[model samples]
Target: MSDDPKTLVSTDWLANHLKDPDLRVLDASWYLPDAGRDARAEYHAAHVPGARFFDIDEISDARSDLPHMAPPVEKFMSRMRRMGVGDGHQIVVYDGAGLLSAPRVWWLFKLMGHRDVAVLDGGFPKWQAEGRPTEDLAPVVKDRHLTVRYQNQLVRDVTQVSQASKLGTTQIVDARAAARFRGDAPEPREGLRAGHIPGARNVPFNTLLNTDQTMKSPDQLRTVFEGAGVDLSAPVITSCGSGITAAILGLALERIGHDRWSLYDGSWAEWGMFPTVPVATGDA
Candidate 1:
């Protein structure tokens, strides 16, 4: 049987399917300053064979004052074209630190209306541990005219999110760790509040992933959501410290066949920066 698109994958699943013609692997690695690892450098040192690097920072909305906002349709199309990511390709993305940044790439593909994408389970660490093939050589770049079809419904602005919070029409899922979500942990960035949005449910992005960094099965993922008081049938919005990991939740929701979901672009970084925005902490 085919695997569920949402939750996670095993190394065995990936090893056996490596030669599939439609499969397109990507190294979507990004790291925080404290981690002290360069994703591009790591990708250059060694990567899965035929895997290309997906630079999240380089491909984002350059004009937006917010960090790493979604780029315009034209810029997205241009970038994908340079990367040779044509439509109809089955994309499988992975990060240096397991599932950290790959989901953002997965979410990016979906936001552009491409659904046949998945995050590599366990990420590069597991792939290397299994003695899988690796390459220092970069893949030859080929141009493809990847067109963009924007799906506005899959995104939420801060204003809309605030409105939703008051109406209780949408459930907000915060992917930050418990400490950050509760304001008990210091934020990585300076001068920002540490709590989460009012009424947001804490579902750390790592919980959705296995020890090896692969996603869990759809049934397992559904349980995780329900446990966090998230009703999949209802409207959903994902947020995180800076809007990155939240995409992981968005990817999970998409994988589980829940299409009525969006990523809060500004996320806590913006919301917390402003004292006027409603901030709530503790178990609510």
Candidate 2:
């Protein structure tokens, strides 16, 4: 509906195009450990009609110690092929928690060089609230070959983030809350230090969303980023707790037409665990 089918889509757009042969809906629900909800169980209980479950954790780079690193090209291709999603298909990923976690999957599709993927604006909760159709049945699947280009430019490692932080050439935006960014609140994940990357600005992922959990308008999103001292002209590198919510920032940047951006995949999870990287605290 916003004319960017590769970034986001309204619930109305999805509902109207639900029966399209080339449309592939994915239930990509994931919750933080403390949230106490099982994503798989919930998907099995209810999901958008003809939607397939996309397990974020299971379909990732398991070799990495960090939580749910982006899956390798082969893994992504295999998983998507197994789900009957392939070239020429329009992907719409959604989560149980409105805007949460869905963007991660959307980003993944992009990183894997799939341009037709998009996140369901407002996700499952909003769809249900609007009285849209949902079903407990799993859709039939047929294998479809998937080709991945693997866009390395869309992801950043810890070393790259550290370099960017020290150089100040790029804007390092943290998606964690102000409290977490300032070390005023404890991290939800264990054994990680508080505070944020040096010179990084805080723009909590929630600040980019409206009350219904849909992303704010492009102009409003620009205002939110500018208010946080992010320079729109500079390239941006977004980071968050374990790189999950960071994709929310990435999506926001994409919505605002900021094409020169990447997600710090390691984020605070790796930076906070390492002794070599510097961490800054407070609102300075």
Candidate 3:
């Protein structure tokens, strides 16, 4: 029932507003290399009615060696225009793995300076389980010019992260699971070191969600953060395997009205691969 379009929207809210002319629903499904699920193929098979597929990897910064870095402003504007998503449209992004990948897209939209976007609570699973309408037909296209004003403060680089870790000024929160954060589990990426940045706190993104895969209440979210020993009052920077799931933490932070936050775009993917930066193993 919360009408905060900048954070999240429930399945019921999306279902009720399906027909609104200004509403734009996007299927932003993506999986890690180990998941073995093809997001584009799945989208072609079935999707919410009138929902467009937002390819995370395809619509990204191709120049970077890293995986799915944010696309340039011109590229983002072009992509949105082609998809008929532009100014004044209220966007709702969802993914196949419930709350997994949608928040990344939501964060991307916000990073591009679009605030009228949200992630679908419980995502595609919840909608389908409720027997909501779905279709495979591609939506009719009508190009619309999308304005771009990138929010530089919303993203951080490895250099900035290194400085923060050294200075202990920002609360760096790692979204990787406890095992990964502790270096008890090997990283999925090859030739990368295990463990996390020094002075960082672990807050696995899944801890903030309910059993049904929907995000927990605001009070519950705050509890989860506090339980993880995170200082919510400090400026926060979220990170994950490849900078993807970290956005889930970013979204959770926003849900609780924590605005002074940024996502480390390189995250562990870049951090682990480099030898110049220091790494910490085991729970502190």
Candidate 4:
């Protein structure tokens, strides 16, 4: 494995660097409806000092019927600006459940042309459980000017993903749970198909993460992916429920020296809705 860029930092590293002037911390936590937890409410209760809540649902492609399609470049810029995230900021994102939603935010930053970002391993829960400093206080808001330089290469659309399935040029990896990928479980979103793409492989997002919410070692990540029949030499496009967990797959790919991977931003939310799109049921 190559010495990959430090796309991840430990909770200790974050605690030591919390007060760094250039570091901007974000609490990018969201939960499914069944979880019965409001991310905003939890953020208000207690969070890393100076951390801001990143709402996945709100900062999305508002016009698309698809759930959480990537927002337009202008909307993304506007949202980050309002959240005080500007150009040249070294962003560190963390979620309540460690590595979950944090990678999604990191992918967002990368898509917007910001690469100086990392996810906090072992996230807020780990920090709190370890008795690191936290507060119920929200940071004072300051407007920051973020330079908008969208990177189209890091993102793929429904059409591109569909074509990729036909051409078999890029390896399609679905990060959804195995049951969903195999059509054994109903989709979380009502009315969507339960199976995966015609030529996709299932690698559940949880497998990429440890019990503590940190990513596995590089060798382990490579093994996990290789077990799913994903060849790192080929181009990769990751998808999952609405594109959230798919970012985790992208992160894993990046960690394993495969930098030429992109995410299906609309993901199954769009593809599963199209009746004519091909879907494969049952495991390989």
Candidate 5:
């Protein structure tokens, strides 16, 4: 598997680079309310050495009613500054839930036009499983300036997603579970309609991972997307329950060198709740 610093890296790669002067590790752990796991408490208990906690909820655009929307540019800059992550730092983000939620933070960095960030493949679980070093002490902090060059092409609004769903020029890929995509299972959040987006293809984010929770190889990722009827030659828009797991699909697309993919920031959370947007039920 490719361990590109800008996309993904393995536990071995992280272990070797942990002591680099410019390296920064972030525990970007987040869990669903039903999961009963507290990300902050988990980090306090034990985490990768020198890793700082990056709260997905707190580091987001709190002004938005929706869950964990991308934070404002100024807010992001201040937060990263407080966290001692800034210009010229190589960031490695890992989540407690293997590879589940960390990619979202990585994508956020990319959205802000940072290129030296990556998600830790297999994440904290695999690192702990390998008996790597852990600690409960907090990291040393220092303020640092972070430059912002927001990349609008990496993000899509609800209006753009609606247009893409109507016009087949761009592929809309849903990363929710099959049951949810088919309207057979209820959404974890209340006040939302069921089913996938019209003309969207389903490719559950978990399917892109292996049993060990590490991502599949590049060829395997390509096969998964193609098997779901995605056109690699064209652009794609990745969506999920609330724009979290959608980044997993975006990461997979990046791993396969598919450079024309963008993420729907509102995702199903906004679309499902809006009675105005048309949603498709059953398999695509």
Candidate 6:
């Protein structure tokens, strides 16, 4: 399979190009509260050589009360500049939990209109397993400019999502676990309601991943979405508990050559908190 820098790159591809001057690797690891894994501490301990730590929580919109909403354009550009990541650089983001949170970072870069970004297939876990070179040292800081042409079409807010739900013209694909989607399990976060957005079809993110945590083939992915009752002809709005795993779904859609998809920035974090929006349980 070809490794597209704009989509997913393998460890082999990364190893061969590790020394490329224009390459920027990011350790964008994150986890839920109960996972008990410290992403920052783990990065400090060991990470891909020349990799910078991209803290999703810290780099997000601090002004938002909800969890890690999209950061403002100015903040995103400033943080990317501070990290020495800028225009003309090919960014490869990988997470500690295989492919968990890295795609979310990839989606964030796409939101900023930087299309030359990709998620590391199998992520840090596969790299470590393959005896790839890693280091604990921080990358050398250099001055770089990241021009922002933020693409609003790649992201949706609560208002847009609600309107789409009511219209039923667009497909809302939820990435949470089936249990969580069905209201059979409690949300990891407190004070949010169970169940999913009204008229949404459930396609749990893990179903799109292989046993090794790498994404499945494009054909396999197409089958997965079709099996989930998602109509490929309709526009898709991907969402999850806090808009993290939702990007995994978005990435899969991209891999399958579906360009008409957007991520819900607030996702269930904003949707579930509001009692005004209706929620549906027990499958779509």
TM-score for each candidate, following the candidate numbering = 0.93, 0.98, 0.99, 0.96, 0.99, 0.99
Q: lDDT of all the models against the reference? A: 0.84, 0.93, 0.94, 0.87, 0.95, 0.94
Candidate 4, residues 1-284: lDDT per residue as tens digits? 23222488877787777898778998999888888989899999999999988898899988988877778889988998898988778898989877778889899989888888888877898899899988898888788888878889999988899999999999999999999999999988888987999899889999987887778998999999999999889999999988888999988888877999999988888888889888899984
Q: Give residue 210's error in model 2 in angstroms.
A: 0.6
User: What shift in Å separates residue 234 of candidate 4 from its native position after superposition?
Assistant: 0.4
lDDT of 1 at 65: 70
- Against the hidden true structure, what lDDT does model 5 obtain? 0.95
State the lDDT at 278 in candidate 5: 98
Candidate 3 residue-wise lDDT, 161-259, digit = tens: 999999999999999999999999999999899999999999999999988899998899999999988999999999999889999999999999999
Of 2 and 4, the candidate ranking higher by TM-score:
2
Q: What clash count does candidate 5 reach?
A: 0
Task: Please give the TM-score that candidate 6 achieves against the real structure.
Answer: 0.99
Question: Each prediction's Cα RMSD?
Answer: 1.9, 0.9, 0.8, 1.7, 0.6, 0.7
Model 5, 141: alpha-carbon shift in Å? 0.9
Number of the candidate with higher TM-score, 2 or 5: 5
Positional deviation of residue 84's Cα in model 4 after best superposition, in angstroms:
1.4
lDDT string for model 2 (1-284, tens) is: 38468898999999989999999999999999889999999999999999999999999998999999998899999999999999989999999999989999999989998999989999999999999999999999999988898899999998899999899999999999999999999999899999999999999999999999999999999999999999999999999998889999999999999999999988898999999999999984
How does model 3 score by TM-score?
Answer: 0.99
The TM-score between candidate 2 and the true structure equals: 0.98
Superposition error at 207 for model 4 (Å): 0.9
